[model samples]
Target: MADFLNNLRTFVRVVEAGSFTAVANESDCTPGQVSRAVTSLEEELQALVLHRTTRHLSVTDVGTRFYERAKVILADIDSATDEARNATESPVGRIRVHSSPGLAYSEVATALASYQASFPAVSVELKIEQSMPGLVEEGYDLSVVSATQLPDSAYISQALGAAYSVLVSSADYIARHGLPRKLTDLADHALLQLESPVSAADEWHLQSADDTHLWTITRTPFRVNTPDALRAALFAGVGIGTLPTYTVADDLASGALVRVLPQYHLRPFTVFAVYPSRRYLDAKVRTLLEHLRATLSPALANAMEIVETFTGDATAPPASPPKRVAGTARKRPAKRK
Candidate 1:
């Protein structure tokens, strides 16, 4: 409380001044107000910290013990304030960042390069893991998470991009088994699954032009929780699997994997950079998050752009007949004599 912190001040003053009126005079407040501050502190703590009579005031055992600890707390606060004031001209602190493995592999490392180069004075301690560490609980300044929605109310979510899952398989596997002509065609193919709560890993919903298609598998060759693992299985030609686009965008461009149903959309795993309450956002945290938004979002979008070029819109009708060149046919080669 604003008034409560000063009560610690008033308590110490009363202990040193040894009189309510004397303490009040030094603090330039009414004796009654000074008396109330100390009284409220005791009431708040449920401890009788002081004994006061008309002319005499004394500290009780609790008051003496509290005074020692309160002095240390006040001193620490003063030191923190001094450091903050001194660094007002430039940001200089270690920003602890935690990120989900998916993002850590995809964009966090790329963004951190420019971020560190830009803010040389601010150091970073980054942990790339799956744990959903709270901003305050785990002393994290920021976190990048792969989730469809906000993880908690205590933090603000800055959407970086959407996590797109696409059906893919190695080129060799597709050349061997053949591409599925439609959703139903998947029933005959070997499928690798991801452990999912939205539905069984074997169940998939794909959005078509005017309707949505749902396919369930009675037989699955493999199932895993992380997208990277699913991608690994697909790369090994284990089976056709659904993998996030962020993780496989490069592979798609290099012809390592091909999209099965380019026209349909898979469930999106939304992306967010979560940070503590915005009220106290510091310079270092602000700069790093800005860097992430500027670089990571565009990189992911551009990578996925390659995938989109192959998939063309599902609702749009098939490409119209190719326009023919008018009167531009090549002349026949002269017969040899």
Candidate 2:
């Protein structure tokens, strides 16, 4: 079986290389050995897998069909091998992660790179999505989200950290228009908005020392679907708009953008790592959660607090494992939510 698999791989390489001699050269083997492997595979399958000549090689009709199916089988076998090995090995499989584009722009990308470096055998596919998908149904290994509430489903959830959106404007805009002293003052300022299921692009939900109110802008200069684009507009001095702190932490430090309202925040955007209900969690998923909880979550959730309290007076967070947070029978929220 092992020899057959090797021959199958050799066949694939030969097809791609277009010559047994080329494949043998690459493999540091003789051309006859490569030809023999393919010949053995053909004999076993009783089909003409390839037609070879002095200068060219082409797949026969049977070879084309066999090659198509062979690739799938080979991939399946590799995945299965990884799964079985990972049972005893460390987390070593490809983890499919879904995250909001805004959140992903922050510590998520950094955390992923760090995790991949720590676990070189593991791979990750981080998809940027605004809508949270059903984990089990959609085949997502994990979902990283920032929301006030998550859909009550059969998934276990954990509070990675507390994140929030802040109203911001270009330094030039703030310099030219002056800062708004009150929430109502925004009525006179230009605005940019992002449309999502939970919040209307044109509507702003704000809370100040006095009260919480939803204000709809009369005139929106730009309404973009992406946080990145909205940020660009803010950079161009389009108007004042709310953006995730993670998206603008560096900008704030650089003085490119200034927080429009320091006293008021829209709402707490809590970050959560959600996964499907299962008897056992995959190591890849578990390690990713661990990494996020330990690193990204804290940095992301507390970025505003850090930026606000840059007096160099704040103490560092305790070096203990984070509390797994949730709303259902699974792990629930820590003190974070």
Candidate 3:
């Protein structure tokens, strides 16, 4: 009965549209195709739904009655279909996300705020760490990490965006110490380093056209384990520090900090959202991923614009060489000897 009613509505649309050709155009099909579908539907119901001529079309008395009831049935069918699709795809339940302290506070937090508003049924638990947490060990459903390369693991990794590290300092620091016009000039100036446990302890690597440079000396007078702390220190005129473009975008915009080495570029790091393997993932994760993909595209584009605004360079420098550090080791003594 429902199937017959559904077809009856299609027949009615053809009649209202004035001709099968008009209905076919509206339905994105050929006139003959629409005609055949109507014919098949009529045969299945053992009823002639319309009186058609080369000039016009008119619904029969039975067709007119069926159209009145068929519209209601068709509306109900559409409502049911929409509900089913929404239930299967809607973001609901609890989701756990782990991210770096910097991103957690800046982009990730903002993205979650909008996501929450759009999907009220979903509850999000965010954990901020200095480094990417072990997804299985920490029991996180998703983790955002910045890395040069993704390891060969069972987890799925999607690149949310990319950013490069830049040496930056407060205007006061530069005014007092003077900006270093060359890479070698930094040896005489103070440097601030990120002391995250999960990151390499080696020298900061920089790249230029056909040249690779490494600044390894701990000439860094101040060091912090987190990006937030590093930003605060830099804001306080601690020293020249290397940070991601997104992290310093606002500060750079406000003229609180200025780019130091405009010629040399640090290696570009990729931001990835890692998730466990699953044949049928939960709707919440899928929806969040979609939101992230859509939301991050424009954010990343803006980040690139900020980079260009600060660097004043049109071409990106070459990639830097990989440097090993104490952080990557499996285990280490309590203190460095």
RMSD (Å) per prediction: 11.4, 13.6, 14.2
Error of model 1, residue 42, in angstroms: 19
The alpha-carbon deviation from the true structure for residue 109 of candidate 1, after best TM-score superposition, in angstroms, is 2.1
Off by over 4 Å in 1: 1-77, 85-89, 196-200, 312-337
Alpha-carbon runs more than 4 Å astray in model 3: 1-88, 196-199, 312-337
Could you tell me every candidate's TM-score relative to the true structure? Answer: 0.67, 0.66, 0.65
lDDT of 1 by residue, 254-319 (tens): 556677778775766667888887875677877777788787777666656655655753222224
Between candidates 2 and 3, name the one with more favorable lDDT. 2
Error of 2 at 161 (Å): 0.8
Indicate the residue-level lDDT of 332 in model 2: 13
**Best by the TM-score measure:** 1
Q: Lowest-lDDT window of 10 residues in candidate 3?
A: 323-332
The order by descending TM-score is: 1, 2, 3
Error of 3 at 13 (Å): 45
Query: What is the per-residue lDDT of model 2 for residues 1-337, given as tens digits with 9 covering 90 to 100?
Result: 9999999999988888889888999999999999999999999898899998887799999999888889899999999887776754478768889988777775677778888998998888998888888778778999888778887788899987775677878777877887787777888899888865446777778876688888887788889877877878888888899887666665655456677767676776678888985456678887788888777766764566544532221122223322322210121122111
Residue-level lDDT for 73 in candidate 3: 78
Tens-digit per-residue lDDT, 1-337, candidate 3: 7755645666879867878988888888888877787787889968887888887788888878877877787789889887657655776777899888766765777787677888999899999887677788878888877778878888998998887777787887888888888888988888888864324544678887678887785555787777777878887887888777666665665566678887676777788888985556767778888888777545654655565565542122223312212121121122121
TM for candidate 3 is: 0.65
Quote the positional error of residue 88 for candidate 3 in Å: 5.1
